[model samples]
Target: MSDRWRTLRRRIITPDVSETRLDVRGFHVKNQVARDILETVGKSFLAGYAIAAEAKDQSIAERRIDALQPRFRGFAYEGAAMAYAVIDGLSLWRRDNSPRFLAGPGDRHIYMAYVGIGWAMARVPRFRWQRLVLPDPTLRWLALDGYGFHQAYFKTARYVYDQYRDPSFTWHGGGPQSYVQRAIDQGIGRAMWFVYGTDAVRVADAIDGFDPERHQDLYSGAGLAATYAGGADEAELQTFWQRAGEHRPFVAQASAFAAEARIRAGLLVPHTEVATRVFCGMTATAAATLAETTRPDGPDGDQLPAYEIWRQQVAREFVAIGRN
Candidate 1:
């Protein structure tokens, strides 16, 4: 296809930017801060997607994304990762670009990049799913997390209100599919933070409304969202922690994860710092270090996926800290 045709094809396939608007999506707006946070995320994501769709090379896209402010840069990377994954999945002609990007410029934004792949998975048909690049065995689960976030954010009523779970979800027909649902629920839990307008109590209440078996993962997702996106103040974070109750360890684990993501990208913002303090009772660096220290040596071990083991270990650290 001609370059113009490719551009047109992408345009036809990509969702409209207007779909991200609060009014268009019918998402709640707790206040200006909440509105700004969600809108910025949408805008950055689209911006990255556009760059990836149009740029002649990965370096060009990386340079453009680098121009974005630190606070939103990772979100743009997420969008770029999504676009590349979509390109790879839909166009057999394209090289395996997503993996290259992930191995290079997208490395710092690895978490967001995996989530981006999940977004691409959501857009592409199931038959083409195998074509998309998901390099990390452990972190690859974040793609499902992204998939969950995309569904909950876009189809809130069915996902959030009705508490839906896809019984047919399978990870390329490997492993127990129930684990896939758990990863997705984590993403849904993350989206709840944004859907409720970053109101800590509302986010907590939404998690509470879910099945008890799902609460720990939900709290993990919400905690990651709250700490990473940071729409709440210290007092609000304290409220969220208090409400988490039995799930406090999970939430703290999320804080550690969020801290590591931000710190790894050199995009640690003040809001993240405040959130880490409230959620983990430590600096963001310390929380990130804790996450690293607790991570399993490999991606799979001891019969359980290494990813879950890593998260469980982090949560145990929090429990050991007397927060249990």
Candidate 2:
């Protein structure tokens, strides 16, 4: 099944030998994989952000995190840590649920988001502060252009470490969880860099290596080894896993949500060459999920209009990408 999906994706994404590239302008939209990724991840991220926002009183946010502690147990962290975890969680959830080949636009959005976040963290102070405050920005400007998006996943990881520092943000006597987080972050960052900075073949390689299924455990283990391998035995690995367990579920759930969202958004269409496919994929997914799952009285309901507004903006962006 996985192989079939891969072949399909390749056929959809890659042009024939006679052609230079797939004319992504108007391909078919056979499956719903992309929509699924967007919807699911968008919902989870929004939920986390809302919780974080309402807890703006710091003490309030801490309490909310505490109240949600059982569900997010091993995943506790401060400030940006929490934000990034939410994003990672969404990615994992999508992967766990869907066919691997149909990442499409939702995957693009994640890459874009990471690039934008990295750029904001690396360049803009207001953007960084805004991210720390709100996490997910409604404004479509959050998606950076190609040049700005060139930075790899690991580059962003390094930036995260450089920008934010907590002397106490370590694991259970092992070392700083940030260290492990940094590696995973960097790995993903590098993967994105390959995707945007280079060619599709490189992107494929990075995706293969850093894929959630194959690399998640390896990345986790590498982090543990880095933080606790000094003088410890097998106990260290077990302890590391115990501490990180809380985050595992969050990651899985969030990834699933992301996949679902993409499908609903229509941005995950088969061969559409519309540049905004990525943005539409994300916003559409978020909007659809919010409409279905969020109560009329909930924040999701309130954000529906906002999502629509953003969708239009994304459409414009797609036109712009196509023009260029």
Most lDDT-accurate candidate? 1
Index of the highest-TM-score prediction: 1
Residues 52-112 of candidate 1 have per-residue lDDT tens digits of 8877788988999999989889999999999989888888686588989999989998999
Off by over 4 Å in 2: 1-118, 125-132, 135-150, 153-201, 204-214, 217-266, 272-324
* TM values, all candidates: 0.95, 0.24
Q: How well is each residue in 76-136 modelled by candidate 2, as lDDT tens digits? A: 2112123332332333233211111113212323333332333323333332233221233
lDDT per model vs. reference: 0.87, 0.29
Residue 251, candidate 1: alpha-carbon lDDT: 92
Model 2 local distance difference test score:
0.29
